[model samples]
Target: MFRTVQDFIEDYRDESQNTLKLLNLLTDESLKSANTPGFRSLGHLAWHLVHDDAGMLRRIGLDFKAPPAGAEPPESAAAIAAAYRETAESMLEAASRWSDEKLLESHNMFGRNWQNGLTLLMFVKHEVHHRGQLTVLMRQAGLQTAGVYGPTKEEWEKMGMTAPK
Candidate 1:
């Protein structure tokens, strides 16, 4: 869990950039990719990251520019990437004002009382979870994925090393 607002900020800065890199790789048509028919599509998962970030922050009394909960994602992959970038900036700006003490305060989140720190932690964890899903969808759509923690299989080959099987 985040103990200081700065911790969350620093982590978010890195993670959000990683997300942006992957988002930029998405093609307009690839957004339709999913694990199976009738499942959530790549577009829906990406847009959820955008909307949920702002919605969760707003619920905690930090309002920012983001799509409304029910808003449909644009067909353009660039638009979704732009929205994610913009909303992430807004969230960083809004969160910058929070003090460590404020992070320790309890607030009702999803019907349970939680520290603001936990909420911030959830922000990163939730995004990471969906990001993993998006990567699978990206692969299914035949798109190359950006590396998050380390080089991908192709990236390893680019480095002239065998990728672990």
Candidate 2:
């Protein structure tokens, strides 16, 4: 969990950017992909990340605004990516007003009382979880996925190397 607002901000900035890269790579066609018949489509996962962050941050007392729950995914990938960018900036901007102590203060969110720092971390983890799902679905949709932490398999092969297990 974050101890300092700056620490969280720096991490959030990086994570959000990496997430946005994957979002930007999304195509309208690939958005329909899911791991199975009863699973969430890639667009749903992506839009959930964009909208759910608002609720998570608001619960942490950030006063951020994102799309309402159950909002339909935009018809275009660029629109979805743009919304994500806008909301992410708003969330960080609101979080910037918090002091370290405020950030660390415990609060009840999602039926649990935890420090705001942990809640922030949870929000990051939630997005990351869905981001991983989207990457898999993207590959299933015949889209080349970008590597979040290292070179993608395609990139690795291009370099005459293999991906680490």
Candidate 3:
């Protein structure tokens, strides 16, 4: 959870970049890949991140339009990424206008009250959880996953370096 506006902004920027990097690793074909017959596909996971963030924003009293419903279960990967970027930018801009006291105050979401900081932290965690799934899906699809938190195996090989022990 963030205590200061700067803290949230810095973390958001870093995390959002990581999310984008993961999203970029996905190809149009791989977007349909799923772990099992009835499981959510890669594109569905991407789309969920966008809509979930918007829901979080709404919980905090920020108004943003939800992404349009897609004919496909989760929509195109590109569309999901685009919506995430747009909503994230707008949320950051709104956050800039909030005072420290306001950020720390409690807000009601889903019948429970939580500090704004908690809500923001949950948003980051939610994205990271889905991103982990995407990394696995990318590997299954024979795509090169980026070294998000650290070097991916492919990245290490490309650099002529041994994989970490």
Clashes of each: 0, 0, 0
Relative to the unseen true structure, what is the C-alpha lDDT of residue 132 in candidate 1, on a scale of 0 to 100?
94
Q: TM-score per candidate, in order? A: 0.95, 0.92, 0.86
Residue 122, candidate 3: Cα error in Å is 1.2
Per-residue alpha-carbon lDDT of model 1 for 28-95, expressed as tens digits?
99888777878889998888878774455666766667778889989999999999999899988888
Index of the highest-TM-score prediction: 1
Model 3 misplaced regions, further than 4 Å = 64-75
Q: Which should have the higher TM-score, number 1 or number 3?
A: 1
Please report the TM-score between candidate 1 and the true structure. Answer: 0.95
Cα lDDT, model 1, residue 105: 80
- lDDT for model 1 comes to 0.87
lDDT of 3 by residue, 1-165 (tens): 778777787898888888888876667788888878988888787767666534666667655555644424344567667777886777677777777776687887777888888887888888888889888877887788888889998889989999987
Compare candidates 1 and 2 on lDDT and give the better one.
Answer: 1
After the best TM-score superposition of candidate 1, give how far the Cα of residue 139 lies from its true spot, in angstroms: 0.4
Q: How accurate is candidate 3 locally (lDDT)?
A: 0.75
The sequence of per-residue lDDT tens digits that candidate 2 reaches over residues 1-165 is 988999888999999998999999999887777778887888888888788644666766788768887789887788899999999898889888889998768888868888989988988888888888888888888888888999998989999998788
lDDT of each: 0.87, 0.85, 0.75
**What C-alpha lDDT, on a 0 to 100 scale, does residue 128 get in candidate 3?**
88
